[model samples]
Target: MSIICKYTIFYLSKPLNITTSSEAMLNQVRSVHNVRPPRMKYPLWYLQRERAKDDQQLTEDNRAFVKEAVHDKFGMPAVIHGISTYDVRSALREKSVEYENVEWSPKFQRTGLIARKLGNYPMWLNNGKSVLTTLLHVIDNHVIKYIPPGEFDPPRKPYSCPNHKKNLGCLLVGAESADPQYFTKQYCGLFYKEGMMPKKHLGRFLISPEAALQPGTPLMASHFNPGDFIDVRGKTIDRGFQGVMKRHGFHGMPATHGVTKSHRRGGNVGHGGEKGRIFPGTKMPGHMGNRYRIHKGAEILRINHKFNIIWIKGVASPGETNSIVYLYDTLLPLRKYKSSPPFPTSKVVEDDQLIDSYSEKMYKFTNQTITYEEEK
Candidate 1:
């Protein structure tokens, strides 16, 4: 890696202007761009400017005021519990289409749920193979509101297409229930109409019109079945102000014989002349991670109904432990389901009694040790 970087620097140092160039060999002399420190010809969103001096002071003062007020008046709101008037089971029964009648077409898209990442654990398969799996718990998820396709308007942004057509509605999903007394009146008002407690984390999922769920509808772990493939979306861990070596995996200048002071530097960005300015997408030292990303086609290994936890087949599922994530059906070409999924989400039957569900290859904790048949 170091050798490759050295060769690149050597190549970039060659003078683009051959006629006015020095007579001395190009390799012997270092170009000004090669020896000098790299500077940003362009700045990204976060690094454009510095905040005002009073901004930090104002934020700290506001935080203190809120803290003191809560202590003096509310004294930490208690966990309010109550039943919702909207009967979910009865509402489903009244629908014109029966459970079997509502078919899952290949074109149909499903709604997603917000889950909290609960770290990871190791599991052994029946074939003596061990696999690492991440635990994502669905934490008191409920549909707050649904905006139909005609009413939905995509956010106006430079990256977004201004003329893009809207074919799906948006479902406001929230997780990790919280009390309303601590929040502002405007914030609490959003949940008041839905008859729900304030949620710690809320996310919006764009789902087709046919998959639109009613407000106050509860979502559970069974929304996905064992062996199903899901897409996990979350913000990756924030790595602030990193160097080229750590951020871009670039091999720095060697740290020995004749090398001095330029050990960790990213040498040379350009050659002098027509193509003079540093390229826009050149990898350099800057902010790293903390971006929203989706890990597609992660297999669901197992699920526990009592705890509302699911074991998915990847340790690299984004987000730190206890952080919120959005789980949805995979839109990948080959991984998409051939048969029907849990259409319109799974129903909670009062008489049904299954504590745990596992995929065929998974080894259950409650089961006996594995034994293979003797060779013939």
Candidate 2:
């Protein structure tokens, strides 16, 4: 008896399909109903036939059975019957999880359980617009290491830490150049095994073990799809301490002929006569900036699936130019998100020869138009 299951990282209320032009059949799928998250190569579907079932055997009558029996239990798709028992550890490893900063929210650890754990966040359009224009860095990032789950080695979390493994989750990869001395011999060997050059940054994504990929995988912008909700995590610009006037925006003493010295100075801080004490949280700024931040629920404008790059909403992505940032699917609910985004995920077939071809006309900031159309 075959089965199907779909354990979505997001809520995904609408029906889903993944059809692409590369496939002779429906390999990738898109829809008018809703815009889904970017399509990363997740090893979520692994089907190894017990006795090599043929294509004709998987008929409509059989699809219904597969849905009710397998998909119902495992949350996999209907047509994944004759596939191999692929590993999911690598998918989780490939993911570079973006977490909400600790200062902004105390439930930092809780977020780990919140994303793909609680429910999927919905995708939404910004300012009632259907499409958006954003930035994407199409770097040649490669998967240097594939640490399968259950077989994960050291560097495990101290129990004080939430998700910590030797390799943590699964595939660890990132942009160009990694400093070899900073890593151990064993760790460096993993990258070599994949025949990948050292990466500048490496992160492990937590994907379903059943749908993981092998080591030495070349990753690019094509990993993500257009119109998905991804949370951006990065370091905010650092601003040193300042007085209440600068930090809290307190209107300091006016600069007048007589009040020259008091200008920009915080007025009498303590209530000398009554309280004789400085209250807590008294907007007296000491240090500022240089904190980790997350721009939650940012909408993806477009995804160059061939490039493994995505363009997201808002220019508030933390850090200055070239600072490393982590982007992940938003871990929020549908009702709480902005409206007008695609309800379900999308997929489309591509050139059979180019499974990882880059998009020529990618979504650019110049392409984004404002709501200033002249009525004819």
Candidate 3:
């Protein structure tokens, strides 16, 4: 055995003097193994702009000062439990400001709101048809900053038209005020100009220059009217590693048959001949959900100004309950707004007397029961 091992080592140690064509093939295999996947491109603004959480260490006094500053600006913190607190609500309520009157036009686009999906419920129409509706609560949303077309620069240009690059602007919106201590100093600094606390979520909206709003402007559910069609975008629920039956809805093999251990397995993914490898997008067991999806042209069935909640027509809005979603004007030509909407955002009315606004086709509980008349 020792003699055989010595002969094998000697033979393996010797270098092979192969032809140029064979050497080229070996080099090609090495190149294939060393090749790297291409990096994905993203917008400049998509890059992480804030430092890691708690990166800025502060003294006890400094932390207290920051909280106190926020309290002073937003008003005294409330201790009540069941009901919504007044302090935060009051802080979000900004005085209405008059800007140059700009008429709504087909070419103009406005900023979107960041709202939380409050779950779904069934609602009856005037015609007695039951429809499932999703409730979206618009949180304390405020405009943090606005970058004009000339000043706004993205890593990859979104438009091929030079005019579009010059005409479109970026709006930075923030929602759900959070404690300053939980966020880094750089993240908190973003709200400094608006005299607001750090937000739980931040979103960027692209709008025409004409629809640009001032920093600190409040966005409400009233921005969209009942009966208006809008688009919703949200992240779907993360359904981790799942089977073919659950992920792709594939029917499993018969349980009664003499199917060995391949009952739930996805059978035969590849071909026998030239197409030997499994094809991309072949349905198989893998990670599911947790994707950004858009549900377009959902009608606004109702709007509650008091709570800043809007009831969307369908329960098909992506994401699990309590997840944040973006609401924007629909881009569908047929469902697009025919009448004028608020130029920038709805005005912050001091007297929120109008609690609920319902669509014409919706059945209002306050109204009397429907009755049928005899044929004439």
Candidate 4:
């Protein structure tokens, strides 16, 4: 009877067209439960797959061909005889190339930058009032790739407004220098095409096709000017597995009275009749923080070109010290200016030009004491 029961159970659980061997059957069962097979070197498909036709294969013969292709694509005109890197750059700047002139529009959008939080400090205003400011250091930032709107296929629509078109170009930007040797072949290949180092962080920014910038173009702190407002976004510091009182800021039961052992406990989660169970999303003790947050309309207090740092007006910028944060122009209605922003991006001409750029209201630390004169 026991043997019959076991046979019936096995037959009922058997799937169609599977191998009859016990070992194969057991493996199939494990796979159904998403269990990793033993001795598997690569878990993801790309980690172990063969290279595609468009991708340059990692072979000696292919290396020279790939290099030649890259040279042809990005090579300067041979008409300029014997030009070095510096000479080419200088010559290009000296020569004025005809570009479709675009009028400045307040509605035009601009690119953004990724920066690291460099701590905060109090700064005295011109009015003698002190305010805390957060310093953001723009790291090594460069353009990686530009995909035109016609070629760029976004997974989902970014806006629901009927006036706006769904098609938008994408700019691949990277920041924070990193050694290529430490990254995977595919990961390193991304920066190789752009002639840049393997970046520590990479992000895609949607932009108009006209705002496209060629790969290898460098970005600097001057991308945002002082007095302009921006939005900073980053992951907040994580405080894992917190209680209701700490996470939700719930006041605990009174210390005295009949509170007893339930001082810190959340009393009476749900009622006893029709609605007995606790509802979903009810604030309870759970994982806290480590969520993406944005600080909008943060005024740019100053910019230091020497150190590539931007001092923002508020100390409430998301992320902890040394953590990455993204800065984009403010979208707030009152703060949003229709005036054209640095189209595409702001170009850093000479480092000396902006040793330290500050807003009019900001009081420079190096400046002398402030005094108010009585009106006659």
lDDT of each: 0.73, 0.46, 0.78, 0.70
Q: What is the TM-score of each candidate against the true structure?
A: 0.71, 0.47, 0.78, 0.71
RMSD (CA, angstroms), candidate 4 = 10.8
Which ten-residue region of model 2 has the weakest summed lDDT?
109-118
TM-score of 4: 0.71
Best by lDDT: 3
Tens digits of per-residue lDDT, candidate 2, 16-63, equal 443232232223346564434454443421212122334555779877
- CA shift at 342, candidate 4, in angstroms? 1.5
For candidate 1, write residues 4-121 as lDDT tens digits: 4445455544554432223344455566652435444421111212223342344778877865654443244432112111211211223322223467788878889998899999
Q: How many collisions per candidate? A: 0, 72, 0, 1
Cα TM-score of candidate 2: 0.47
Question: Could you arrange the candidates by lDDT from highest to lowest?
Answer: 3, 1, 4, 2
Residue 275 lDDT in candidate 4: 93
Better candidate by lDDT, 3 or 4:
3
Residue 214 in candidate 2, Cα distance off native in Å: 2.3
| Candidate achieving the largest TM-score | 3
